[model samples]
Target: MPDRAPQPVDRQLPTDEARDLISLVRDIAQHEIAQKAAEEEDAGRFPREVFTLMSRSGLLGLPYDSEYGGGDQPYEVYLQVLEELAAARLTVGLGLSVHTLAAYGLAAYGTKEQQTEHLPAMLGGGLLGAYALSEPASGSDAASLRTKAVRDGDDWVITGTKAWITHGGIADFYTVMARTGAEGPRGITAFLVPGDAEGLSAAAPEKKMGLKGSPTAQIHLDGVRVSDDRRLGEEGQGFAIALSALDSGRLGIAACAVGLAQAALDEAVAYATDRQQFGRPIADFQGLRFMLADMATQIEAGRALYLAAARLRDAGRPFARQAAMAKLFCTDTAMKVTTDAVQVLGGYGYTADFPAERYMREAKVLQIVEGTNQIQRMVIARHVAGPETR
Candidate 1:
């Protein structure tokens, strides 16, 4: 089956420029991305060329500083672009989000010299990046990570394995966190490591149910050395940096989840209206109508939540709680909506002939990545209830 083009999302943009940007993104998604998305994803083929084109077109670095070869769009605008792309293909949308996350440390916390040196190429010069934070032993309890980065005269030697790293093998740069002192979050430090650094290796890609076009694998940093200049923020600040990136990254994930849900809703509606049963279209059934209505409502709610969080970020205000809530709600909505889309199609949806099954499988991952929905609840509760006292 041919890949379905992303239906336009009715966006409430802040400016004419934002509207034009969304229009451009929709054009690209319809012509370039959606057309090849299904086939490429089915083949588990990574579209490096698409990313290169995005880099050249300045779409890869929206929401970063303009001086650093970035588009300088606000987070709200940038996120809607992500939503459109995700509706076209989850791999492309989520890959771009990870790249943006990988650049967060250098953009937000790097020294002037480091920003001038690396941010430009990283943001738009055809270079891809990955963030390395979750270790094999520390998925949810990230503060308990075991990766170590020991100071060696004028350099740091990094050794440990990072798990579930997107773009693990193909990334050109990695923003890595490692233990530098005592146990726990305070001891963590961040480093910028080149993917080709000596002793850095990526294990085989995971055979995942969805987003297979994107490589998820274990990254081994065995005695990988980087000069002191490559360190991101101050020593013992890696966990904080990681958290900051994730707050923003959660919004990206929320946007992707909303887009995926929207796509499923659109597919369901199209199929329901076109496919007839009992001498009438399924869309005429009140039960199916309620399901579609709920799906659309959830998608709209998730989109609004992510946009609200993005606006808060744009205003330099506190938004962590909102970001966490958006991630939790939007991802869960995606899982629900995609599941309903499969049911709307019945047996036909269970097969690979339709994209509903793929959307369902893809939606499952959004709940797990960035942070598990359970972890997102903990984050939200921490903000809502304050840190629990002994």
Candidate 2:
């Protein structure tokens, strides 16, 4: 397992369940995912084999209904699994989380027929999914999206661009947000666009600072036509659905952030104890030990926050603000922990010879993606401001 402290029994979840999931994820991480993480990351290659193995192990659908090939696990259980995967490798964890977010639209809003038609493949991981919300002109302010989908007889012609899409070129389907009514948020609609559809092509992958193994691209919809059957919810409900999906998606990012922080802390601790300086291990130095202590403390706190928010969700309570708080706190902690991890390794940390450098690079994207830390602060501020200001 990760170098994380024991799960407090009083935490907002069943201790045994959390332990079981942690064990399962740890098994996958150590024996399977961890070995190839560094290699594929260096080669800038996606771990399709790892993803396939996860799918076979039923890790892909951790929190969905069993009727549709899902695990029927609670969100609390699901997030821990995500945490473990991320500790092993950020790319796979983030990809799986995004895939689950994309699946939410279909699971939550799709019609019975639509769910029946698509849920099996989606939950089974036979079809990889991506979400298309951010546009070149509109990112954090997603309501300003300009992507258009005009109705024409039995089909809708979708034409616009979606930016910073995870799994853009690789996914079999995309959950796309496009404008269908008049201008502004009220006009937007969501559609399930197949990769094989005409006029739907992804631009070459963006060269990123990290998570390079997970493809990120700009998706172009040039007069792509789709039947109304693919529509998720009513025409103008896209923004709401998107926001709702983000609530859960933020938890996934929070889990990933926590995992990344834990990995950094573990690596730093190991290196500190092993690398000797002045004929003694540097871990014995009070200064370095203090930094390790802080990293471990922050990770544990972040984990608690995210787990609390997840339990709130599982209990059917209002947790949007809490989720945002966890996302913001956890991601920021990841950046700090990973940066210090590099510091722990000193010269070695700066080079590719160690995982600390890669962790530092990967930590940056966690702060930027999934509703940047700035946006997360705004989200939290709204809660403090109350509904009148909101």
Candidate 3:
């Protein structure tokens, strides 16, 4: 028999409204996103229309204040919605996460006037955003970025190349970190640069191992100019703003990782129950069953870890350490679970005819994005046992 469709996750939502919201998200995932995920991803096609639909449906700004076109959902509810989207398609889920990351500086630190003027359009008006912090010379050491933003009267002229920007070529706006003062982290400033500014451009997308449907490219700002009003937060405070945004962004990545691992586990289970050997389904074998069991356990643990971190965030408490721990563990779980899923299906898992191979490939990137697992470890270590002395 053909593999059975995966069952819906039995989520422990806080309210009837939250449950209803999950139901709506699941319906969209099943009907609108999941149906063409494989085909579109294989073809490297970005699903702009799906994002448009999500914006219209109020899914784009779930964790922000409703006064500014946001859904006003807490991080816990929002992360669950992200999990559903990611289980259907990682491209969509991670894309939404990147959009939220890009909007964070403005939403969290912008002046009231800035929020009143721009938040509505960005939150729900069908605009896509990109976060630009990584440069050609700096990835994990984002504090060392050399992108220059020179003040000229009331405008800032930004010039440099940002590497590995999600939605680089296609974003409507970008939250860019550029050096505006001396050297090092304290010199940085964040700007809200329009994607189509005079000298802003993106190079061809990178040929990545996974998430091909989501464009990751080098964004070049050659004297790109933005008015002083477009600056996010105070000048020389960009690094702090970026770090604060990343704490929440790591949770988003963790939720997406759990979702990806869940999908892999579901695929593995379906294959095990249907594929036969020795006159019985492979699921009857103790070894394969054990693998499945382990995969499931890891996924559940990862889900719990990310949700606990999300709850901490929703409560307005310090969660950077928990967020780092969640990112590290969940992404590691995704890589392990997806690889074991590939092993479960044997030869068939290695082919494009099934999704197991794609899941494995996609799982690898989760370990590296937002911040590498190595970076996460450092973050956790700092929180637990004081900063390392140089």
Clashing pairs in 1: none
| Candidate 3 lDDT over residue span 1-390, tens digit each | 222233599899998989999999998888888878888889999999999999999999999989999988999999999998999999999999999999999999999999999999899999999999998899999999999999999999999999999999999999999999988899999999988899999999999999999999999999998999999999999999999999999999999999888988998888899998999999999999899999999999999999999999899898999999999999999999999999999999999888888989999999999889999999999889999998
Order the candidates by lDDT, highest first — what do you get? 1, 3, 2
Candidate with the larger lDDT of 2 and 3: 3
Stretches of model 3 off by over 4 angstroms after superposition: 1-6
lDDT of 2 at 182: 84
| TM value for model 2 | 0.95
lDDT of 2 by residue, 1-390 (tens): 222321222234466765766677778888777877888888889887777888877878889888988988888889988887898899989989999999999999999899989888888856788999999989898999999999999899999999999998888899999999987889999999998899999899999888889999999999999999999999999999999999999999999999888888888888899999999999999999999999989998999999999989999999999999999999999999999999999998898888888989999998888799999998898899855442
Clashing pairs in 2: none
Instruction: Give the winner by TM-score: 2 or 3.
Output: 3
Where does candidate 3 have its weakest 10-residue lDDT segment?
A: 1-10
Predicted structure with the largest lDDT when compared to the true one? 1
Model 2 Cα shift for residue 221 (angstroms): 0.7
As a whole number from 0 to 100, the lDDT of residue 256 in candidate 3 is 92
Better lDDT candidate (1, 3): 1
